[model samples]
Target: MSEIATSEAAHPAHLQHHFDSLQEQSQVASLGMWVFLVTEILFFGGMFTSYLVYRSTYPDAFAIASKHTVILIGAVNTAVLITSSLTMALAVFASSEGNRKSTVNFLTATWVLGFTFLVLKGIEYTIDFHEHLVPGAGFQMAGTNPGHAELFFSLYFIMTGIHALHMIIGLSVLLVILYMARRGDFSPEYHSPVEVMGLYWHFVDIIWIFLFPLLYLIDRHR
Candidate 1:
């Protein structure tokens, strides 16, 4: 028992002063991340509820507005985000396996994919501007109540804009992780940062998953 205790006392360099063991540290980090995620869910939940109310109040207008959205761009961005999530998962796996090269490769791929999504989104926004879909003065829609249609556009801009902001933040975090990864800052036993970042990336991707169908596919049957 004394020998076991002595061996356990030898902490890894990555272990913080507040943590007694790697396991304890990992648990704390994971718990913190989950708590943060819960708060994020609540934050987004309010907007979602607002969306539901507005959508319900103006279903026809919402449907018409959704039809004007760039479905092709939304679909392509969805695919990009999903693929990025897969790469992020691979990055976490590589980190856990102590393969620095693989981790860096996968993280780079994820970052590139995220950047591509943003570029495509920017193009979509430019198209929206050209189409006069900006939801205020100069906004235009046909065969629906323009006021309700404007509301739909308002929600569209707010939801998707917030989502893009999260994507940018996620990409920035990935950049920091990539730099640290290149420096061999992580190991199989101390890759909690990578794991937590993966959680965040996945969460962002999931948000887009919801947004795609809501914002793009609501009027497909028409």
Candidate 2:
């Protein structure tokens, strides 16, 4: 504990001076970060539950909508995002070990993969638009489904649209982190910002993992 205190004392003013120890600081930061993640899960949970309820109520609509969805594109995006998560993990590892150069390289790789994912998502959205899958904008009216077919497209747009917004936010955060890294703002001792951001990145990846199977790969065998 004394060694930790000494390390904290020697650390820079950028870190909170109120914290008595670096370990405490890290623990608090991590806790706060995880709490934020929990809230994020809740935010998405509402939509997921709504999807389930609607799917059950309108199984035929759900199946037809699912058929129109590009599962292949979703699968490719999943691969892209998982690869980005791996690189983001490596970036955190590099930061922990004080290899600033490697950290930068890994972050760069992550950014590339993130952009790739976004591009593919954009293409998918465009295709959906062309296919008249969007609600109120030329919807195909998935068969004579018992329930409201329009509701299905509405839910689809709401869910996927919110997710895309999150991706944009993540990309912006990564850019800020990259700029700071270029400026030597982080070191092995006080890269809590990077660590927190990494946690967020991984959480987003996990969300997409769930989304892929539910939204794309589902048999929707109604």
Best by TM-score: 1
Per-residue lDDT tens digits for candidate 1, residues 17-109, read 677888899889988998999998888888889999999988998998899999999999999999999999999999999999999999999
Clashing residue pairs found in predicted model 1: none
Per-model TM values vs. the true structure: 0.95, 0.90
lDDT of 1 at 13: 69
Measured by C-alpha RMSD in angstroms, how accurate is candidate 2?
Answer: 3.7
Each model's lDDT:
0.91, 0.83
Residue 151 C-alpha lDDT in model 1: 92
Query: What's the number of clashes in each of the models?
Result: 0, 0
